[model samples]
Target chain A: MTTENHPIDQLFKEKLGSLEKNPPAGLMDQISAKVAFRGKIRRMNQVKTAIGIAAAMLLIMMAGWYSMDQTRIAKNQMPLQIPQINTPALAKTNQESLDIKPTVNQIAANQHTIQTTPAKNTSLQSAKPSKSLTVQKNKVVSASVSDGASLLAAQTASKEPSKAAKQEENTVKTKAAEEKTVVKEKSKTESGSNNFQKKNPPLYFADAGVVKQTPSRESGKGNWGITAELSPSVASQSVSGATANTTQQSTVSGGMLASYQVSKRIKVSSGIRFSQMKQDTHTSYTLSQTSGITYLQPVDKAANLAGDVSLYLPAVSSIVYSNGMKTNPTDNFTSDIAQELKYLEVPFQATYKIIDTYLSVGVTGGLSTNFLVGNHAIITQNGINLSNGSTGNVRDILFSSSAGIEVGYGLAKNLIITIEPRIKQYLNSVSSNDQVNYKPTQIGIFTGLTFSFN
Target chain B: MLSVTQLEEIIYKCREENNGAQTALYRLFSSKMYGVCLRYARDSSEAEDILQEGFLRVFTKIRQFEFKGSFEGWMRRIMVNTALEKFRKNDRLYPVEEMSIYEATNWVDETISSITADDLLRIIQELPPRYRMVFNLYAIEGYSHLEIGEMMNISEGTSKSNLSRARIILQKSVAENFGNEKKLVKKVL
Candidate 1:
């Protein structure tokens, strides 16, 4: 549509085009009022959008920084992450002066499996000194054996093969004690036992607990410890009357746990945790039949005062609309509404270590009380935030029980990495609504890093 | 009476939302923009309504102007847009005829300049909203049919048709006012 040969264009161009006639009187006042109004509205809308974006960005940044810092702190806390109480005791076995004979002595020193077992003293010279130290192929395993008793025990056992013929002439009577009840320090030097006795630390057993305990460190029995666990929880809701399918998005739970070893193999623990159960109930609820015609405004004034329950009125002329618009009375609406319930859970659990080796396998069962911190039931019609509502008749206190198998690996001396695939069942309904008995259950694999205190 | 620099200073001050500068700025351009509003509107009161609305937009969006092009031209565009918005809202109500009339006629005869701008303005105002809006955008404002279509929210073809209809109507108005070429006037009638 090019204007190549238009005629009337020329006439209008000549006549009224760019005409500068004066407008009506006092028009400026009207303009002033309107412009001021527009400016206020525009500024308000811009401010609202800015605030929303800023809040979302701030939340994400804080969450990311927190996660990174947590990982770094947890990493710095494992196998011998705690300082050694006696360094010379740890260094005795690491001496490189050993020829092939002492190297065989190192293999003898590593026989901790027999030493730790009271029933069968078949010791294994375990070579894990620290979690950070990766196994070096040619490096002597003696560096990992911190105790002198084990080194002498291995050396004596290895020396006996050479002296087997003369064993009757040199019968050394050494008293070997139970694994936990203290064993008196004993060492038999090949030439003279005095040199070996002098090299062994006078008293290392009392201060030995200062070194970090690896979760499954064969000889490690931790006294006291703390652990932090994080898990992504999957929750499903079970109700009584109406059929509702509930789905959750991004349900994460994190908690700090503290444990005290009641015995050598059992630990009693308690901790504070944060967990949320968000349920999106996709349900078609039938409205009780109204006898008279009820005209609902898109933004009903009464909706705000609905007192803990909001009726999500949709913007449709098909039903009873605000401006006296009416339609056929009986139509059931099937829409989605998001209901979130947050809890500050306190769990009192006991863990029994089945095999406290390099990889510790344990069975854990816990009783937790989930305080119904927040329950928000927002009624949305076609994805519009109509109003704030309550999860009607929600019980404040909820009791739950959980059980899981905790598998912990000694990452370093004091630091242990653990994973527990746990399932929690609600003892009572989270919702007190008689018509809907909503009991939610969550299952997740909880990952944690444990730091030993003593 | 103000120089270009003085006008710009007033505009800058108006952007800061000074009442004095805003009134001064309004006084400076209101007359010329009112003339534009009159062409699009049905009467003086409607024209005044359009002028008031356009000026309100000008004041609210004063900060957006970087002073690159002509200030008057920018103001004119705002005024035209304000008029067009009014037209879109009320376009269906206003009466105009079918397009597809013959084109390539002599624009206005020897008596074209004899009629006053006000008289031509009146003839333009008499047109239905769509025809009047298209005619004013294409002829007076020097916008292309495509531009008119975009401004008026219509197709370029529709723009051209409306322009043609506006022209045929104006030709009869011109012929009747000058009282010449009885047959041509009757043909438009």
Candidate 2:
């Protein structure tokens, strides 16, 4: 690069043309760590976004399903018809009722059977007058048994010549007993409709050839679940009427849990969850030496010589002999350092529900055992690293107690999503000293998705 | 010395996130990149920072390179851009009117040749950021005034003025170091 042989351009092209100077040590590490950290943060944000979307989708699907269920239940809850055959036997009784939700066709079949039973019985007896009562009873009962004549067959039969008189009495008594049960069921249905107008009434009933079904409350008593939980946590220590602020970190925990429904409103659960905590701590402190040694590190040689008057033409040599490098005063030097610690924790917790419904409000408290996994420390000044080593005498095992309120929503049958804001209090010190007993309390908002195996 | 193929192979491994290859690549090109950074930076530490930042970008955006030109030249451009970015961040546009313009002078051949790379680098560093940028772009990098102006977000006239000011300062420094020269030592590097 020359401009009509301009001396300045000539000087650059000839004397100060190409250069090859090694960069100071440890620069590669800086670049690598920063790049890796950036990539990790990017990946983490993506995962968080994905999880958030999945949770939202689940919520939408659950809401849709719930509304669909409510619509179907409303259609089914319309008033049912009463049997006209035995109106006199309609009586109410005090007994714990069974709730069985059957298909719609089952209710129609019951009403048909009650209306046709008496006429079918009379026709059968008239057709066989001389046959024994046992034979006659068998003949009276139809193949589908829609007449419910099997109950009439169980009555005491008179061998008297007056067959019509005995038959009529037996028929009336059996019809009355059947009507009494129906009236009790009808009263229950009316009371249930008053209590829950939105709910569908039980369709199944006790009868010959109609299968008795158990209630859904019994079916919902599931005892086991697997939950996946994640939380961003911050830990701090209580020290001499002041709290030492620690950096915010995150933990991911999940495990299988077993629960016992001890009563209608209470449940006890225990689970083993694997979790972790990470802290990157930066600190500044004074470091004084007995007889101070000057830290003579390299400085910007170009910047140092820019203003010095006599230093431009220092004693002729390959390098400027004097006043080339600069030094910083270390007489009252302060040190800046970093330390990182990690722990893998196993938590065993119990939960008690207060308001258990479609949305349950619960109080959960538990203890966790923490195991130290990784620790690293590095001390650097400005940008130059001074020292790197290990931390000593740190406790390996620590115990902590955690308690929180968990609000859970049923996404679908046996699938639940919960958000729990919990606080953990460490019982033991992280350091191995009595005086430096740093007990940290951490607060975290945990989100979990649970699937139940009933 | 490593061959071009070897360097390319290291780059390939680096693309695969091989840490050893990344370190090898850094060892291969760091010195040259550091030299470029020094001319653009105010101090040695700032130069290291620029070099580090440039290497990181090289690794992150290595896939963008089509391998159409010299890899060293590509890395040199990144270093220059990194330095320029530092200036952009600080808005380092010193008022041109505030500068005391000195007359350009001639120096001795011995002085021209004898000026240590460090001494020349010092004089360039002492120039105001704008002048330093223009001098590096025009004199060392061989960018035209118009291109320098576009790159630095300044008018062509401002770029020319800054280069002239930088040359004046260097000329004054040389006149102090050693008088005029008849014949210069060739190829000092």
Candidate 3:
């Protein structure tokens, strides 16, 4: 172009030319490599955390399985000392039989004299029969017939009569002894019922026709035992038109547990559960809202990544189930929690049991809070009408859920090694900011150990 | 004018961690960006500082670029932001109220009509930092007085007044040097 007759524009253009002569030194390589290295470190740290969580979960599961197995074995050995009670009753029965045989023969020899001395012998014989009857009744009390004296007393009435009048007295004594013996036998046959039957009576089975029905319904309240568990979890949130974040949440919960075997394999357990939880949640905000997208001039794109400090409350209560059974290997020992959210976060996870060698996979979800936290720009539509004037408010809260699978190795009678992988997603919106649509989701792998007392 | 595809390629290369691509892109835009930075800086060195920092930020955040408009335009805004940062850090800006457009429409003195472009540029560079910043942003850079006022933390009226003062000073200098170019032209003839 020809120079402008207006010289000021030309001079201004010339000065611009001069200014171009000097350029800043290049430091791009240094800075770029540093930034990249930092990024790599961050990624590495994430991997390390994931691995650690898996290991911890595995440890917890292994411990639980080991403890459960130990409890089972201990339960199996419980009836060891208690069964010996039957031996004493058998010995007493033998002693009573011996004493009765000799006395019975002597009563047979005195039969004729017993008949001739009727009036005089009547009261004496009646008194003796009554005394023996009283003694026999006392011997048949709830106590086991383990005393030799009680059996000897039971044998005395069997002797003393062979003639008609004497035989009648003998019959009365014999009947009483028979009744006492029958009571003792019944009590002895009911050894199984004696233990638990006292605590829970079989009122429904009280019919005499139901003989041989032990009063104690073997409520095999799943061999009362402790359960230790370690489950590896993953939770995350994502933003629309931006990067996704996946976080790992590892937890170990277990304590002294008492289980009553309600059946062969089913048990209801109640105990204190103290849990240690660690969560590494990563959140990403798309810089779309802050970007110069609408500006007439160019601007750099913006994105923000932040980490959260998570805290979990301890849980306590009864664990009701069918047969101390792990319904879904991947999904075991889950607590119910309520939350709100804005994103579609799907988390994938793998978990392992160190002791039982059990492994499983699961998934869960949570929503991003971007719209809820920073600018609150996300406008929500109350699928229902809200009392507030605004159409939709910030959805800072998220709904979190998980589904998973588990694989385990039975290490001991009650111990198992397990691994479970799970995925979690936030179903709620993460941003109240209209400009951002983010949800939190995560995927993780876990390894742990579990113990069952069954 | 580069096609949108070409712009995307450049941006991609820069994001792929290519140093050469970054340097090339910087070279292509440095002149305009330096002009922008100069408007907010006290001197060329300060302007260069802003340019370097701004370019670094541009590369760092290249992934978020959502090609809403011309890529150059977007980058230009970043450089302006960098300049603003420097201005803010140096406390070189002040607040001024908006004046009517008519108040800012004053003309240069006819006495300086004969002055050369180079002489006018020298006068502009010599103005105080604030006046020079207002003049470069509003007049040379084609920024609206409202924008200059916002960028410099001043009212639109103050930006207009500063620009007017800058023009008056430049015109006076031009008048003083008005005869020099004529003498040089006569010598060449």
Ranking by lDDT: 1, 2, 3
Candidates by DockQ, descending order: 1, 2, 3
* Top-DockQ candidate index: 1
DockQ of each: 0.46, 0.33, 0.04
Off by over 4 Å in 3: A1-454, B1-4, B92-125, B149-189
**Which structure among the candidates has the greatest lDDT?**
1
**Chain B TM-score in candidate 3, rounded to 2 decimals?**
0.70
Runs with alpha carbons beyond 4 Å of true place in candidate 2: A1-10, A13-17, A59-454, B92-104, B179-189
Superposition TM-score, candidate 2 onto the true structure? 0.40
Query: Tens-digit lDDT track for model 2 on B43-89?
Result: 89888888888988888888887889998889889889989998888
First chain TM-score for all predictions: 0.45, 0.40, 0.24
Given the true complex, what DockQ would model 2 score? Answer: 0.33
Give lDDT tens digits, candidate 2, residues A1-454: 3243557766765555587798888888898899899788667657655664587455445434544653684344322322233322211100100111221122222322212234333443343321111111211211111123322431323333246645654664455456457767987997888778557533321111100111113324435555555555666545442222234344333333445554544455555444444443333232222221212111221111101111111111121101222112332223333344556666666676677776877787877787887654433344333333334446788899989998876655555667889899989866664445557787877766665566
Q: At residue B150, what lDDT does model 2 achieve?
A: 88
TM-score of each: 0.45, 0.40, 0.32
Off by over 4 Å in 1: A1-15, A18-21, A42-46, A76-90, A94-158, A161-454, B44-46, B60-69, B85-119, B146-157, B174-181, B184-189
